[model samples]
Target: MSVTSRTRFVNPRLGTYFGIFVSSLLGLLMLLLIFEELGTAEPLLRWAMLLGPIILYAAIGLSAPTREPIEFFAAGRRVPAGYTGLGIGVAAMGATGIVAITGVFFLIGYDALCLMIGGLAGFVIMTVMLAPFFRKFGSFTVPSYLGRRFESRPVRLLAAGLMAVPALLMLAAELRVGAAAGGWLTGEGQGVVILLMVATFVVTAVLGGMRSLTWAGSAEAIAAVLALLVPVTIVAVMVTNFPLPQLTNGPLLRALMHSEAAQGLPIIDAPALQFALPGEGMAHIAKRFTAPFGAIGPMAFVVTILTVLTGVAASPWLIPRVTMTPGVYETRKSLGWATVYFGLIMLTCAAVAVYMRDFVMDIVKAGVPSSLPEWMQRLVDLGFVAIDSAAPLNYLSFAFDRDSVLLSLPVAAGLPAVFLYFAAAGIVAAALVGVSATASAIGNVIAEDVVNGFSWEPLPRDGRLHVARIAMAGIAVAGGAVALVAPTDPLRLLLWSLALAGSTFFPVLVLSIWWKRMNDFGAIAGMASGFAVAVLTILAGEANILGIDGALASILGLPAGTLGAVLASIATPQPSRSVLELVREIRIPGGEVIYDREMRLLRLKSRERSS
Candidate 1:
């Protein structure tokens, strides 16, 4: 546990670095705001906000090159719990989680809480059931762990293949988000900006791998959180004379309820928590801020939350983060920190939704059609919101695209242009962290578990590093193409990705760690069946061809995977004695990683053979 000369802990000046970064960022933003006040050309300011932070991120990436495998693959396993936790939180939220969730809350009111609740539950499961054990096992990737556990290269390769889709989907979603933010800021097309974003992801990921991502991601976390909080706080202070948006939103909720009632939107005596589809009977009329389940049904709510929980718990990218920490104890503490930061993020999101709803309701009550707010016009020009008609504007007349609403919120709040620019930078930061993290995971998995697993001989150190960098760039390119071609919103793409993750990895991961009876046959059968079911059901759900929907895909996918794994294990021979012993060792705490030791021995044997 003690720090030694050989240990590669993060620089102790990390705090100092972060402190300086934040100050410079905010100072630059304020300068831009003053320029606006002094009547500088608007186009120049827009371009600066769009490109400034990206430049900073690239600079960080350029500084992160490393020749060592451990440094590139695992950040040298010396990241403190707090920093690791921040990285986890940022990676989990990405641009989709932070932006889409808030926008969904704005659109659906209380029903959006399900996503937050499910994610928090997933973190708890990770802390209690998964992360500590993974840290003890010390694999570079999830597929690496599975390969080692089953002692089968085929199992490892299959896992790498199965996991690639979810990772790519997530990468696509993040790229789309960053592209949208950049498009909005620069008045450019998404296709063009997405290409730019892809290059940025590749540069950052290929240079330092996890070592760069871990540290830069921590910095992005700080910027994203501050960007989310500052505008919301300013808006809160203006309306309620309170700076704490998380706590002072009660009055706004009451105001929203009154506005809905006065607009004759309909009111019902049904319990606020009752489940009802959008515009359904009693619950349908329950559009008040405290009301729940109005936007989605009971089944949909349950499925959505469960899908998110399982997806997050077994996220391919997030799980490997446990290995970046110092030990099992630090892994546990890191997850705990992730929970705290994630909760703060979701709470702040809710506050954004409430304040946003309050603003729209006031406009509706004003009953001004021709004099619609300049902010709404800005949104319309930007294509984020559209007015339904030339008649008096009501809440229903304004349609907000959920994927882009977080970027629009500053406009909706009548904040100065600089605030809008600052929000854009924050979204860019969120999307970058997500892009780098997912690309890193996919690249490492492809190189280590798939390519290396297929090799007749282990690759040399330098060869491995080169392959990894090339793999990362290639993955980034594929992800960018998907982002450009897919018509789905970032949220929908994100949900599908989560459903796939939950279906394929969640069951096998849990069983492999906790069930000694699990073998290669079970692992293969479970992954194949679960993945097949998830894809078919997700497509069917998207097409409405069957009773299934995307939200419920995992409801069937997870059970299918679990059943396949359990049944296949029962029908097959038991695992060998060595594999069983490895399982037992992973369960215990405070020991060297068995996988690391085996890898070293295997390398020594290879060297002897070559000589």
Candidate 2:
């Protein structure tokens, strides 16, 4: 085969491999379900659930190592659109969707739809505005693209530094979720489980970089989707005698609304734009379930969606995956696949929330918190749920950990603990997939963009791959340290990541493609100012200096970043003719990737120097 043909060859059996991989997982679960019915021991089931997927994914990573930089960095630009979309969708959902957001839905009811709306909309924006252009340029990392577009190493390095902040923050967030799931499975301390989780993430990415992550992530996405839907569907059948939870949950929602009234839950008297206090004590009454802006203010909700929307549009991890496809057309198709998968999983998330609420109401209506169901009481004893033995158990009488509610659903409905383990295993898969993708992006920026940009002599291909793997390990350790020492709420960490990313990259990424006037000065200024403002606002909000929190903190940062860029670009001289030509070239499609042409020139020069 010609060199180009060799580079573009993907294994035809890849689909068969992943199909069997997913089927095997399902089979294992079914066998475990049978064991549970036969009264198998709980610890044995936990070990199987915790270790099985890890062993399988690790084996894939171990076998996927590649010395070729093309394979390591961009999967040789040959992944099918279906797999590419599945990878992106998996990273987008991660544990935040499977664990935290499911709990968000259960806790906040209709208000949680903001997350779903922002995320799905972000995919749309990315599809239309960014992905195709980036794929045309074909740089493996976002910093590489920005640096080359502006023809400035300083711009590239600065983007690399700014990108790492959100990347590591997201890394820590996923690790936190994984640790929580591990703790539940093994009955071990989060510290020990987090260490294991960190090792797993590093191993998955370190072997083959993007090559390993893409395929392993595809498998992980399958496991996560199946894990989420199967149990929820079973619960749907149990509750409504219907197999489709997404469509059949309407009656359950109505019943939940009635339950809110029966429990004397009051509608909020505050304006939709005003923040409300979370009530104190276990038996405190919450706002009515269907009330808009009950969990957060209107301003906060709108800002959160905008930030998350832009963040998803400009997500560094997601952008690189688009470039792994065959071309601009396949890239667009992959995102369409992402939309389908993301929408399905999100609907399942809504179903999980409704089903979980229905279960909680069952306990509340029973009016005896002390006499909780065995499963619910287990969760309570584990500190995942808290209930007060008051005379009349209402919504106020019980409190739930947002991270625990989805996992607790099987047991809440008196199902076997095996189902709980399946849910936890799926959460682990989702978290690992996210961490692997983010870690790969961060390592690529540091190794290929930042470190390599500073080098007087470029490393050979093998040397570059080694450096990237080392960088991946270093980032994993740093992220693991944060996850271990100061693991905060996963949802809060995710918000910081989204806010920082949207503020720092969103405006610059859009302008770089659409506006020819965007120069290196603007890119540098925009990224720096946005990064600073986001960090300050989040810190101030946490310190109570301002009301800004979650995604709301980015409201000022984004506009400030945009204005800073525009003004800086205007004050500086317009970009040179060559730079303007480059921009025009990037805007057009169906040509050689600019990065590939540049690399070929570099290789030719290296050979001339050697001779």
| lDDT scores of the candidates, listed in order | 0.82, 0.82
lDDT of 1 by residue, 1-611 (tens): 98464235557887787788888788879989999999989889988887777777777777888888888999888888898998788788588888888777777778788889988999999998889999999989998899889988888899999999988899998998888888878889998888888877777777788888777777777788888889989988888898999899987788787787677664334333233323201111235566655656666778878898999999999999989888888899999999998888899898988887887787787777877778878887877776777567666777776666666767887888889888887887888888877988999988898788864234788998899999989988989998888877677778888889999999999999999999999999999888999999888877877755665679789999999999999999999999999999999977787656766887989889989
Task: Measure candidate 2: CA RMSD.
Answer: 2.6
Candidate 2 TM-score to native = 0.95
Cα lDDT, model 1, residue 45: 95
lDDT of 2 at 386: 80
TM-score for each model: 0.94, 0.95
Tens digits of lDDT, candidate 2, 345-458 = 888888888888888788778887566778777877767778777767778777877777778778777777788899888888888888888888898887888779864245
Q: Which residue pairs come into collision in candidate 1? A: none
Q: Given candidate 2, what's the lDDT at residue 292?
A: 82
